[model samples]
Target: MANTRPLVAQWSRLGNSSIAACKADIPRPALVSYQTVRHASGKPASKDKDKKKRKTRNTFRQYDLKHAMQFSLIDAMHYIRAFEVGQNPASAKYEMHIRLSTLKNGPVIRNRLRLPHPVKTDFRICVIAPPDSKAAADARAAGAALVGEDDIFEQVKNGVVDFERCICHTDSLQKLNKAGLGRFLGPKGLMPSAKTGTVVKDVGNAVKNMVGGSEYRERMGVIRMAVGQLGFTPDEMQRNITSFMDTLKKDIAQLSDRITKDIHEVVLSSTHGPGLTLNGEFKSANSIPPKELAGPL
Candidate 1:
């Protein structure tokens, strides 16, 4: 009772000084609105939204699972053969070209496929090894058109590389390298390398494989390989094409995690006919329109 009235008056007098000292020592932060703080920091409140928009623009278009096409192996063959059969001279042969989309760091894929129905061609193979070596004898026995080391080298040096495929033994590699034939063979894709299975220990097996194998190489993101000739039965052609596509799919599956898209489109055509794009989904052989052919056969 004695101090109550005076207590407020007494505290006010004491501290003007104490309160000012306390405030100075604490160093109070300035009161700023959220908008003012953001402006001062030079960062927009919508920065996250802006980033999201940019990310969406750069990403690949994601197709819905329902919209994905399911192509029929048999139906694709039917349409492809129909187009070829209608060709003027019936195209010397039918070729299958597959185009792919890949990421920057994707694997460089090349495969040698032996189709169920081989495409018959006039292409010949030559073997370079010691004339008396077993490899040379094996090569000769295996159907190599030409087999000799120095003789083959001479022919190659003199601009007489008539063969489409060249196989060499490990022993002759040094000689070939010394001859500086790389400048000649490299551009033609006839140079023998381990990767292409053109350099081998068993010349017989290599030559045999080369004779039957169809090389599918990825160049500029496209794979071009001969599926079968127009002379083949439709059933044979279908099996060949299906086998190739199945193998391709399996190989690509190994790299699926890093791939952007496995295949963009698969267009089938003969040597002379217009291409028919197989829309990832299969259609019945009877339902496919013959007029889907791009141009007059």
Candidate 2:
């Protein structure tokens, strides 16, 4: 906010270095670029120096310590359906589901489902498989509670599934609804029906990982985010940068093709009128673009 140094100059500072190390020792330089810390006061004018707009630069410049400070990351893609940056919230009621599929080399998802002890916490988990044992095995790995016909009926009879702590595993589909598993779970929207991927004979491992939070999902269209604010410690921002970039990289690798088609862009920027963002126009294994979506507009 005060006397910020140019990104290139701040690149060598102990503060930035220390901050980078704290975030699993991520190299600050990799998360961002040197020029990102510095820039002309304003946009580049058509001429070398526009007398009318003296403060602005005629060309694009990178953001560094002097020009940019702080960063934030948000999964705008996962944002609820029908979201727009400046649109009215009343118009949007998001009802989107994130789907994940397994790759040959992807990690085996932990079966255990972790939830807060309170039954009303609303992080409902459904373990589905062709047979009770298969679903149980995956849920067990994730540490999810295992339920048989007995548990399902009680929940339905009581008119509530403990989203906070409830697991159902049954090979018989009829037993579930006949006992009223649907009545309670249906209203809460916790019931695992055959329509959603929840009832797959063998959920691809990626979905299990998603249930575990290690999984990544990429869908079409643009999503926005504001990386950070006007002035933040370099150390304060590296973790976000690292996590965002890592997930993005994994997503790209998972899609050998259609990376750009699915991923429109990657950007980063501050919440104000100025800052640096990766202007990667297209997606490819060679380059990862982090776009600064919103908040800065």
Candidate 3:
């Protein structure tokens, strides 16, 4: 009985010491805190608060051709002049915008026309012909500003294309193609080609035709070109317009093969003016009321 009592007392003391050591080594979770942890509120997040506010964009208002009013050639010119009040009368040009009822992928309508009163007189034409040859001399006499063969090609290669128009004689067309100047001249519409009538057997006649003449081309089913200066008389402007429209119709009839090149609408505009649609016959003085411009002028 005495041995049993001692054994029980020693076991109880060991258990009590082990329990106390365990309690001292363990830490209470309440002492540790997380100050960086975020809590969900009904308000927006902190990241959203740092976002930038969007700004309102400015816009320019322009005249829409869909809502344009049809006017006679003379009336349209006068209206355009009204818009060019503060601008130079001589510097402002009369532009014709012709919309064709043709496919965007249709054949391009490109040609040159000599107006009654030329819109511009300062056209620098470059002629590709043998230097000091009869063709070169004739080109110079016909108002070719630059006339040469190898010299002109070298100048073009050096990126010194000082001419606005280019014409190549049939004999020099091969040389022009071999010079690889198309990379430079094609984009500028200065590459001489038989399609555009810039390639010819008669260099002098071609140069004379190009000088003071306006070239028009179809793009996206529309052909736009400056017809005359805004300072031209309405009669002169009418004649120019007639010559151009007649020539355009004739060219379309002659050139169109797979697709029709019918003109759907023709709009007249100035450098800084709104486009006005042409309603009356291009060759006559017939007047039409402004369908969109309703108020008193």
Please, what are the lDDT tens digits per residue for candidate 3 over residues 1-297?
Answer: 332343345445655885765655544342222111222234333445546544433222223456666787767866787898778766888899998876555578899899888999899999999988899999999999999999999999999999999999999999999999989998988899988888888899988888889999987777999998867776677789889999998899897376666677898998899998898653235544333232222
Maximum-TM-score candidate: 3
> Per-residue lDDT of 26-111 in model 2, one digit per residue for the tens?
56556354243333445442354566657654222322434432223322221211133454433322111212332323332212
lDDT of 1 by residue, 1-297 (tens): 332334345444655775755544542233223335545686544557577767433333334435544445445555555666655433467777787766434565677778887785445889889999989899989899989888888888899889988888988888877878888799998899887778888889988887777878777667888787665655565678789999888778765574654776676666766565566444465655434432333
Instruction: List the candidate numbers ranked by TM-score, top first.
Output: 3, 1, 2
The C-alpha stretches of model 2 lying farther than 4 A from their native spots are: 1-138, 164-170, 203-207, 213-297
Task: Give all candidate RMSDs, comma-separated.
Answer: 14.5, 24.6, 18.6
TM agreement with the true structure for every prediction: 0.66, 0.30, 0.71
Q: Itemize residue pairs with steric clashes in candidate 1.
A: 70-281, 70-282, 71-280, 71-281, 71-282, 72-282
Candidate 1: stretches off by over 4 Å: 1-91, 104-106, 254-261, 280-285, 288-297
Sort the candidates on lDDT, descending order: 3, 1, 2
> In candidate 3, residue 96 scores what lDDT?
95
Which model scores highest in lDDT?
A: 3
